[model samples]
Target chain A: MGRLRPGHLVEAGFWLGLCLFLYVYSFEFDKNIEIYKFGASGWPRAIILLMAIAAIGQLIHHYVKGDETSSQIISAAVDDGSEEAAHAAHHETVKWYLSTFALLAIPFIYMRVPEWIAGTSEPGDAGLHTARLIVAAILIAVVVYFIRHHRVRVMLMLPLFFAALLEDFGFYALAPFFIIGVMYLFGERRPRPMVLIMALIFGFMLTMFVKILYVGLPVGNIEPFYSIGSWVVTVLQ
Target chain B: MDAFNNFLQGSITLFSDPINILIFLGGVIGGMLFGAIPGVSMLTLAAILLPFTAHLSAEQGIMLFSVMYCTGVYGGAITAILFNIPGAPENAPTAFDGYPMTKNGQAGKAVGAAVMCSALGGVVSTIIMMAATAPIADWAISAFGPPEIFALVFFGLAVAASVGAKTFWKGWLSILIGLMIAVVGLDPVGGIERYDFDMPYLLAGIHFIPTILGFFAVSEIFVQAEKKVRGSYKAPKLSVDFPSLSELFAHKFAVIRSIVIGFFCGILPGIGATLAAFMGYNEAVRWSKTPEEFGKGKLEGVISSETANNAATGAAMIPLLALGLPGGALTAMMVGVFQMHDMQPGPLVFLTSADLVWVVFAAMFYANCSILLIGFLETKTIINLLRIPFQFLAPLILLLATVGAYAVRGLTIDIVVMFLAGVVGFFLRRSGYSIAGIVLGLILGKIGEQTFAQAMQMLHFEWSGFFDRPIALGLLIAGFLTLCGSIYGAFFKKAKTPQTPDPDSA
Candidate 1:
């Protein structure tokens, strides 16, 4: 037991946990008609056994044949203190990761929480999408607050998330405008030519994929959005 | 002779189409460009182009893409020899010898030898691919079953175990970790979610792109980021050279040896071009009259390495087409594209799309020819990729990584998975565990599962019934030997004098 390595210990611990969880999986599986002499549990049980052997094998190999200690591996990793120094010295966008985590967490909440209470007005607007928008708004507002408070890791999520959404809203026409807005915001305040670049890119993509391939896009009631393609489809029809 | 006639006909058709000619040229050019640009990986290029060619005849589409694969591998040597930055993994062996040639004022000669040797190996492997494919496909079709597939996966895992790192235990650990991750999403048997905890997207299992990108590409980023911050980042002088015929003829046997090594390596199933190149170089160094001149400027060095790398391309495609086991990462992408095109890739595919497979073989031929022609022409210009500033280029690649991951399944969850995987990969890589095994594992996991699960059903879940199939037993034995051989080779090989950094590269 003492011969076990930290790696194996951790791995074995995981396996032990996984074995317990397989019990939950068993509930969903067929209990009728044992396929093997051991039933369906035969293979998964064998897998657990293999995991234990592998962990033990690792422990024995390291303890018996190896000479280097854990400190050597640790030192080899931490020897480069320069990276941490660089990060410290060049630190600017502080709330970047915070916003990213919040955004990721909001989606998880949406998956589980049917009636979340964050906005001034409850997103209990009696729709699935309404809940999503409210969650997005909360995520965006929380991120913006942190970005303003800390002023590092420049939170670029608000612009990027909204822009990607615009492509869905049938402002399929306004998609390029979104890129320009995001690019300018990302570029830190010069959003003009970047906006134009987005327009050019959208036009190019539209001509290439949509026009040439005859694929349709969601024009989302944005009236100016659906024109040439719709007319072409009509002509063909 | 019928197969030979088919190849000749493929060649004939290759010349008949001017559009194909332009594609061949474009492939060569694009290959060189992508190879020289360190962040623009061939897998990314192959994956992106896979969908765009949906309308083309299978042979034409394959011909276009194979050109990209073969040339990309060859094109990487330009940067390796000129800038000392191996633009691709297989090119790492070239930088060892080719950059030394540049320092000795024979950059052109090194490049020439590399191109020529790559051509020689490619032609040999292409011929071998054409010849061996039918027989292998026949046997593979006859033997294909669940037990057989499980045996193949075991063998693949063994290859990863034996070849991964110094310690066999860590390699096994790496494989296990990959298998665990692969178990995420739906259980293959009844489509029950195993690790997803009830998420909707998890029901389909983890889309492979995120896993592969995490294991290979993102992990690479983590490694680069950490190393870039501390290492003395130097670039090689962009001196270009091509070797004379005499210099190449002297190494003709070396080229043959490397191609043989590459073919065998590809047949083994999971290990890819990098190993083939490394193995070829090691053998060249071992057998050379002046073994001392290996890591220094040697025409034979670049020749031996590039030839094997390119040869592996055709070699890898064999199993993917025949048995539906993807030969490597690029082949896996091709398999995905094949599925997207509504063509199942295994033996049944032979009966359904025999003509399409021939088209693929035909495309492989033209692509090989294109690599030979345009690869040489693009060498002089490949050095400009290093000119891009690191600060700007790194994030651009990260953004592309996000886009690439998202494109796979049209999910933001993929992007998040990609980001997390990248970070995990970075640590695994620095710690010396092979990421290759992990990627191979994730890709092979489902294939392994379906095969294993099916075998279970076939046997009436009998434990002893799995080995009843001669083919399954044969594959098991082969896998065991391969695993043992790789471990013996990697661990027992004597260390040479530790290599120093190339001054020209610095």
Candidate 2:
């Protein structure tokens, strides 16, 4: 038998452990509900059994496939990479990790903010939810700059920063800034038409969503936004 | 002729009121915008707008929701065609053919074909729903029970066999994982929590909308990010080339067949436009003379899926209006809208609110017309989405997807869960697992479990009693046949020549 790679072995172990956890968890399912003939645990146990069967099947497939082909393929691929290619691959891997980190951390930050703001056990209390979305976007930009290519990182910064300010500044306050940030990120140095379109879009959103539809737009977290929102709502009504 | 006069009366009533016209227009435009935007689902928009409709008169309220319902299904195909990112899950199939066509610089033709076929399907199904509501409702009411529903869902899972994954076993494994995820909440029959791990969020169960946003939109964002890192990404030209009239006429039979498939699938309780789209696409592939052209940008593939999904819109109302049973989630929300207006659906609703029913029928017709008009107008602008730098557009999609996930339940956990699901989905797609198969499994698993448990309880847990119900037995046989066919196709089909891609391969 060909020796299995450590990665394949680790994968097999992971599935096996997962199946064991599911099996153990199935036992904790309560079964006392009178309406159910076989109780709640019965279905879960049946599912767990099927899952165990599948896990075993997965293990065998992995072992046999690994023995037949994967090792040879990996060896051939590894042999083909030159020094420059190897360096590029390492760089790509770093970028991948950076992107993944941003993806994962932003959600964590967003989840944790409500608890900090409201002193509540709930991780995303309603009061802090929208605010946290903005903060998370800002954090994502900041975090990406530290780990990502500088050019790409610069592109991510402006839009994310403007998005972070959207809740505090409201539609009228943030719309032009967002458009400007987008154009700058895309390297649009000619800004006259961009500004014109942004003005029209903001007008459209204000009329359509705020005045006509009455959707709950956060009238900026500050005074002018509140006054603008009040003026728009009153005028429309 | 009496039906004709009632229809005319309803049309007049609907068109005569300026407010009603405004309501219909709002629903169509709003529904389409929601549908086209990534993360905004038809159900979510319908739910949001539903509360506002309470103040309107019953006719206006129903008209508003009805137009929203019809146009929402039509709206997602635009984004699906332009970007490979499907605005809704059902539109994913459209992206297979539609996006490829866009890549070939025929986005105009693709969107035009999709719009024409979708409108055709919607108009045809609305007519059928208006004409055959009673008869179809009678059949559905008699044929469907818990056992039958369970069997139908089981048959739906058999679709995993046809999803053309690299490995059929991987697809099955994905389905199993989805099913397990579905069972994580309370047991439907016993009302006892199964897999909450003592978390309050898990106790309510996994919401499918957020899960869908994760699987389709967020996952695509991750894939795009990876591509940007690899420096292999290029934005497509945004110009759309409209299809010639002859091209639209060419797929006449496929459109009709898809409409039938879509309507029947929609009539079945719990089955929705997503399944209809899949089954319709599959059936078109089954019958096509040039089946190999399907995923590579065939017009028939686009038409079949779009027509079937929209056809489902009208047929879905059949069960709701005729029997008071919601055919799917959107209609279930519509049922709430009806109840808020002191109206109830079902047979009595027809007798008591006959004119209102006709008005709804008229509204649907108007909605389909609006889909054609507004869809044509928007295609130029929507196609220009491909012109935006992919790097810029990717972040925008991420923003919309986050908002969509949050909008579903107003929970931060949902957004977190969506991101997690995206990470998982990214790997699953890379490994050639069937993302569609897993999504189907997730959507149908809860319904299957609930119905199966109900059937078991009804039969006192005598497993053999399932076969006693003729409808259930027939559906079970169908499920078995589909599974066997998949296994045969997987193992027994001839290997392709090295240079040629298999027609069935994703």
- The DockQ of predicted model 1 stands at 0.13
TM-scores for all predictions? 0.77, 0.67
Question: How far out, in Å, is residue B237 in model 2?
Answer: 6.7
Model 1 preserves the real interface contacts to a fraction of 0.03
Model 2 TM-score, 2 decimals: 0.67
Give the per-residue lDDT digits (tens) of candidate 1, residues A15-107: 556656754565554233333344433344455455555555555555554422221111111112223323443421335334544553543
Lowest lDDT block of 10, candidate 2 chain A: A71-80
lDDT of 2 by residue, B318-432 (tens): 8678766555546655665676677766666666888888999999987887778877787776545435454444444454555455544545566567666776766565444
DockQ of all candidate complexes: 0.13, 0.14
Q: Who wins the lDDT comparison?
A: 2
A1-237: candidate 2 lDDT, tens digit per residue:
334565456555766687688878877885677777678877666766766665565455555554222210111111111222323434335465466445455435544664576566442355555555456557656644553344333333333343334444554555556555544444445668567655665566556555666555544554566577666666765
Winning model by TM-score = 1
